[model samples]
Target: MKPLADRIALVTGASRGIGRAIAVRLAQDGALVGIHYRAERDKAEQTLDDIRAAGGDGFLIAADLADPAGATQLSEALIAELRARRDPPQFDILVNNAGIDDRKTIEQVTEADFDRMLQINFKSPFFLIQKLLPVIADGGRIINISSMASRLSFPTMPVYAPTKAALSTLSRVLAAHLGPRGITVNAVLPGATSTDLNPLSDPARAAAVRDSVALGRIAGPEDIAPVVAFLASKEGGWITGETIEASGGQRL
Candidate 1:
């Protein structure tokens, strides 16, 4: 039997990039995925199509994580979908991968920028987990897609880095809170991946990035997906409250 033959997984920001890769990987491992998108319906559909093409199954969910009410909206949609499918309210995996990045220096930061960053990157995930706790199956997995910026300082990512740091801290706290139930909560920090969010379109900049990595190359989203898939599998049950950095030893 497949390791995740009967599992259910929700991956936010799954319309593209790292989230899309993670969602597809989970489906490949036998999970029925819930692919969440904020505004990119077409991209979300493409993700579902990829899942189907791989002989896996999935559905699409839409919710704007930037809004204060977004978490509630997403949870309601998920529960409603499960009910419509005549399945139980519980699911096996939650991947909090939806987030935004503001490439502004501290001097350029404004109140609106800070609030929006906090709302989408940290607050939404926090409350989403709170709202879904009741339905998250015991022995389940919660994987937060954090960033290497949370640990390494980047002057251009002042606000974005902190938000990811908060998420990583939340993972640690929740792991202990949910430990007795046998659930595992973890944070995955991917460094300089070749996603739309971190485009490597500029040859010079891409080369600079590649040279910095100990692996001598920039990572693709596929490189990070397996890490998340492992964390979501039954084999990953014993691990919790940990931050797994898939950075290819950049700057090490």
Candidate 2:
């Protein structure tokens, strides 16, 4: 559709699954995408390949988003990398789709687990956005990948749920702060999707989760990618400061 023509987008954790899908979608929508990955260099290249095969322009980036330094890398230095490809250019869209989910609850949650979850899911995105704020041009779009856990209290995901909630709240505040500059900040809350992060890898556990969804199935990466691309496009220009859940009607 070329709706995002001439726009530039940077997506973190764009190695596989949801991040990979979003990278392809953004490129398909006409934005030159910078696909970011941590150690999944091959997967990132695959994502870039898909974009190229689809007649879209895309580039690849690698960074450990879980690292504290990674946050600053994505926020500031990545801009230089992107600009190196095109002069007088700045990113118009940012998708904070990078995160780690802690399946452990309070009883099982270790100090290290909680720290890692908080660092990647909440802390990194928070600081990264702040660092990149100056480089984001006017009317930019910032999309954070939150989880439906933010809207519901949980048993096995105490730490993870709170992390998403904090991000949701951050979006509310950032929306107002960025509004004056014509930028919109928002969050996407997904219920349950089929990705590598699945703790229930066993057949029985997977079946249970699938049956619980209203769609009678778990979602794939494709299911979530389009929504992200839409939000970053002109169509989503009016949507901001809110968490939009797209989880096949899970009974949270």
Candidate 3:
């Protein structure tokens, strides 16, 4: 399973949820995972520590993708940091998984919410990928964390879904542009996963949501991690510009 052994992977939003799971899974798969977090230093370190406990190599990086300056600094710092490592990591994998959720009614949706969603989820990935594209090895992989909401639209999810859609679009274009260089780009659309955002400890809402899924359970980040690892590996080298849904049969 060391398909990615010696590979260096940078996963944004590695502090928790699906992103954290992806980071740990990639580490287990033998990649030197770079754990990225915005402000959750404690959580990020925990991810790195878990990798160490498992005998895998890892390092922690702090990056605020929500701000343009921070995104630029984060990208540059990663390149600089990886360059300083022993083998000077070429960063074969880039998982653009960092994002934010804005829950608001149609009328309640303000300009600020829209701006923040696009900034972190859409714009940040756009620029970060551009900056990191050169460093990604030929035939490398890029997986963008999108949402099932991109296709399953709802009233309060207008802005969020649009952001995911834009990200998917970006993934497709990058796949085409980078394909000549042998890079693969794709998106993963997840359903209602058991994340901090879901307040799973709250039985009422949790029950209601679980009942909605055909699996009768909400997915955990663990449920989504292996697929990401597979896509990042040579096994998924053939898949590019694809949107693989990791939902637990929740609705459509």
By TM-score, the best candidate is 1
Candidate 1, superposed: residue stretches over 4 Å from native: none
Ranking by TM-score: 1, 3, 2
The worst-scoring run of ten residues by lDDT in candidate 2 lies at 74-83
TM-score of 3: 0.95
Query: Residue 61 in candidate 2 has what lDDT?
Result: 75
For each of the candidates, the C-alpha root-mean-square deviation to the true structure, in angstroms, is: 0.9, 1.7, 1.4
Cα TM-score per model: 0.98, 0.94, 0.95
lDDT of 3: 0.88
TM-score, candidate number 2: 0.94
Residue pairs in clash, model 3: 139-182
Worst 10 residues of 3 by lDDT: 81-90
When 1 and 3 are scored with lDDT, the better candidate is: 1
Give one digit per residue, the lDDT tens place, for model 1 in 119-184: 999999999999999889989999999999999989999999999999999999999999999999
Clashes within 3 Å, all models in order: 0, 0, 1
In candidate 2, what are the lDDT values of residues 68-165, reduced to their tens digit?
89887766557777568666657899999888875776889888898888999999899989888878889999999999888887788888889899
Point out where model 3 deviates above 4 Å.
Answer: 86-89
In candidate 3, what are the lDDT values of residues 1-252, reduced to their tens digit? 588897899999998888889999999999998888988799999888888898898888887888877678778888887789745447899999999888787799889888889999999999989888778888899999999999986788879999999999889998999999989999999988888766578889888878878887889999999999999988899999999888888884
